[model samples]
Structures are given as structure tokens and as C-alpha cells.
Target: MVSELRIGILGAGGIAERAMVEPAHEVEGVRVVAIGARDPERARAFAERWDLPKHGDYETILSDPDIDLVYLALPPITHAEWGIRALEAGKHVLCEKPLSVNGTTASAIADAAAATGRRAFVGFHYRLHSFTRRLLDVIASGVLGDIERVDVDFSIPHFVVKPGNIRLDGDLGGGAVMDVGCYAVDLIRAAWGEPAVESATAVLSDDDPRIDLQTDAVLRLSSGAPVHVRGSFIGDDQGAMSLRIEGSEARLAATSVIVPQWGATLRVSAGDGLLLEEKAAEGDNSYARQLEHLVAVLADGSPSILDVRRGVGTMRVVDEIYRAAGLEPR
Candidate 1:
């Protein structure tokens, strides 16, 4: 087992700069040793801006003997290839979400992790947040009775800001479902067990019919409960991210459930019309919690709460939804 994990970050994207790199410094027993990008000069600039010790092309960091872990913040399309490579090189990996473009690639990553005996983690940081933990606790306590239905809405105005962004590109594993619908689907799977896609439909972009701008899916959990999930890119400017759980005995609602690191409010209403609210305490950001968890898995042999296996399950649901909507998987 490893003691301290030396991390090398792949990709110099927005998430790499904002979430993973700085958060690595805050986690004890974790160090950011290098940053790599396809462009050497871009990597150098990112490293210099972050005050990191080393920067180079992707091969430079992957071949470095001292780097025990690699944080892959590249796009979804590149996750499988790089994740497999890192595991084969005897390094643990923390790959960004959606794990891959589809279930097949995700399964390959899982297989590689098993074959190499290396720990592979997916970046579903919201699963590690305090609010999500509390939400799970409340559900487990039966306060919500038998959860009958769930409704989730997570929409953002991505197309408004960057019209031709990669997120709008169908070829690069881009769309509302791949980009944001994964989170909605994950929340459902986490709250209610693995689900079967009953039916799905989507609104394709007017300019680019190949890409989905909005999607609505119905999923049936093993427990017979139904979940309704909606995601969109050309949504209201106000940004909608909320969840409601309806049960036989009570109903629970939460705001800002996605990015609860800023703040979140949970309300529990009983059959008698009484209401209660619980607010999450300020703590380490989600990325730090995620980093700490990865370190623990590397140092000891703790099982990841949101492992690649679970990611594969989620991707299967995503693929099915696209097919039902008469569109191909990204």
C-alpha cells in the first residue's frame, strides 16, 4: 500500500485549474507534483500560474516514476484511453465524470483497474458532499416513508455563453445528457437503486439536430418507484437545480442539491403538514473531500463509494435514454 500520493494532473482545462489542482494542496498526504497538457507551452503556463514544480507533455508525466496518482480532467471522450494507460503504468487514477462516452468504454476502464490492481475513481464530487450524505441518511431513516417518486431539474445556459462550445458538439461526446444529465441520473441511482429506463425523449437543437439541447427521461427503480429527470443547456438564466422526493408518509425537498458546497437547504414535510428544515455546515469543499477519499483508497484498500463500476451502470442508462429518444449515443 502507498503512504503518500504524489499527483500529476492531465489537461489544463477549466476544471483542472479551478477544482482539482488547488484542492490537492489542501488535502493532507496529497501533493500536486506536475501538470501535463497536449501543448507543452500551455502546460508550462498552467504550471507556472499554479506554482507547480513540473510541467510537460502528457508522456512526460505518465512516465515519471515519482508520480503515484494521475488526475485526468480531460474531456469525456479521452477518459477511457488515458485512464487505462495510467492504470497499466502502475498509477492510480481519478478520472472526470461520465467515465467515458458510453458504457463499453467505462467497462473497459473497470476491467483494466481490476487487471492491474490499481484504484480507479470517478469524479462525482457531489456524492461526497455533506448535503448529499444527509439526504441519504434521511432516506435511510425512513423519514420519507417508501419513496414513491422523484423529480429533478438541472439546467444551465451553456449555449448562451459559448455558442459553439465542445459541449454542443455531438462528435466529442457532448450534449445535455452527457454533460448535465449524468448528474441527474446519478442522483436518482444513488437515492433509489439502479433503475431501468422506461422511456425517454429529447429536444434536439434547432441549429444542430444531431445534438440534444434538452432531455426528459423516465426511469423505474428496482423498488418500483419512478424517477423523472430533466436536463437542458438552453435553459432559464436563473439556473434550476433542485430535487423533490415524494413518499407515502412525507415529502422532502432540497434546493441547490447539485452544488451544495456553496449552501443547501433541506425541508422535510410530514403528512400532518408540519415542516422542518436542515442546513448543511460549511466544511472542506467537495473537491477536497473527493481528493481525501482518493488518498485513503490509495494508502489503504478502502472501497470507493462511487467507483467505476457504478459509473458504468450510469452510462448504460444514458445510452438507453439516447436510443429511446431516436438519437445515437455520444
Candidate 2:
């Protein structure tokens, strides 16, 4: 067993700074050893700001034997290649989602991880939250008997900002589904266990015909439970994120299911009346919890809940959604 886990940041971007580097300090038995970027000066600035010991190009971090893990915050298109390289270098990888541009690449990453025996975790931090665990427990308890339907919608109006942002680039695997819609799709898969995409329709962006501004998909689980998911990058709605699960006996609804760091509420209703209501306490950081779990997995060879295999399953759904919508997979 390892005494400590040393993590190297492979990208000096916003997610690397806010989600990984900052939250890593709060996780025990892990340290951020170095940061790498295309520009060495930018990497140096990020490393200095985060109080890390070293900063250099990507090769430098990859060559360092002291780094046990690599946190990849690169674009979705680059995830599979860099992830495979990191695993080949005998280092575990925690990559930001969507794991790859398509299902094939995601599967390749999973295969590489298996071959290397290196742990690969996707950055679906919400799965590590206490409230999400409670939500799963409630679902498994059978209180909401026989879930029949699930509705998920996550929309944000911020797509209008930064005209040339990567999220708007079709070649770079940018779209509503690839960006925010992934979370909704992941939530559905988490609840329904990898449903098959029945159908999907998307509204393409006016500026870029290949990119979707909004997408809606219908899926069916093995048990025939139908799930309706909608994601939008540009919408009239006031930035909403919620999920509703309807069962034969009762209904469960949660608000802000995506980023519950601020706080979240779950309400359950039955035929008689409102059955239960719960709210997440303040100071709940999913990133910290996720990092700690990865450290545990690295040190003791424990199973990770959001392993690379799960990432491949999620990406398979994503690829099918694009095909169903009559669009090529990004």
C-alpha cells in the first residue's frame, strides 16, 4: 500500500484550479505535486498560485516518477489520448467528463486501464456526494415502488457568453449534449442502470449547424422504464437543474441535482400526502469527497464507484443519442 498519493495537474484551466487543485488541499493523503500546460509560464503561474512544487510542459509531469496520479482537465477530444498515455506511464488518471468524444474512444480508455492495471476515474463528482448516496438509498428502499418514469432537465443561458468558447466548437466535440447534457444523461444512467436510447431530437445552433443548442432524448431501461432527458445551452428558462422520478407508489423530486455544493432539496410525495423532505447541509464539497475516494482506491486497491467502465457506458449512451438525432457523434 502507498503511504501517500501524489497528483499532477495536466491542465492549468478553470476546472483544474477550482475543482481539483483547491479541493485537493482538503483531501487527506494526497498532494498536488506539479502542474503542466501548453505554456510553461502559465503552468508556472498556476503552480505558484496553488503552492505546488513544480511547473512545466506536459512531458515533464508525465516523466516524473514521484507523481502517482494525473488529473486531466483537457478538452474532451484530448481525454482518451492523454489518459492512455498517463496509464502507460504507470500513473492513475482522473479525467474530466465527458470521458471521450465518442463511445469507441471511451472503450479504448477502459481497455487501456484494464491492461495497465492503473485506476481510471471519471470526474462525475456528484456521484460522490452524501446527498446523492442518500437519494440512491431512498430509491433502493422501494418506498417509491417500481419507478416508471424519470425526467431530467438541466439548462443554462451562459452559452451566449464568450462567442468562441470551446463549448461552441463542433470540431472540438462541443455541444449542449457534450457539455451540460452529459450530466443529465449520467444521472439517468445512474438511476436506471444504462438505459437504451429509444429516440433523440436536437435543435442545432444557428451559428453552427453541427452543434446542438438543445437536445431531448427518450430512453428505456431493461425493465421498460422510460426516461425523458432534456439539456439546453441557450434557453429562455432561468437556469434550471432538476430531476423527478415517478413510481407507482410515490414520486421523488430534487432541485439543483447537478451542483449541490450550494445546497439541494429532495421532496417525496405519496397518495396520502407529502411523505418526506430533506435538504443537504452547507459545506458539502463533492470534489473533496471524490478526491478522497480516489486516494483510497489508489492506496488500498478498493473499487471506485465512478470507474472508467462506467464512463464507457455513459459515453455509449451519448453516442447513440447523437445517432438517434440524425447527427454524427462528436
Backbone clashes in model 1: 0
> What is the lDDT, from 0 to 100, of the residue 120 in candidate 2?
88
lDDT of 1 by residue, 85-130 (tens): 9999988888888788999999999999999988787788988888
> Candidates' TM-scores?
0.96, 0.96
- Pairs clashing within candidate 2: none
lDDT per residue for candidate 2 within 40-158, as digits (tens), equals 99999998887899989998999999999999999899999899999999988988988889889998889999999888888999888888888878887889999889888888765
Question: How many angstroms is residue 191 displaced in model 2 relative to the true structure, after the best TM-score fit?
Answer: 1.7
Give the poorly placed runs of model 2, Cα more than 4 Å off: 158-161
Best by lDDT: 2
Q: Distance from true position, residue 172, model 1, in Å?
A: 1.2
Candidate 1 ranges beyond 4 A from true positions: 158-161
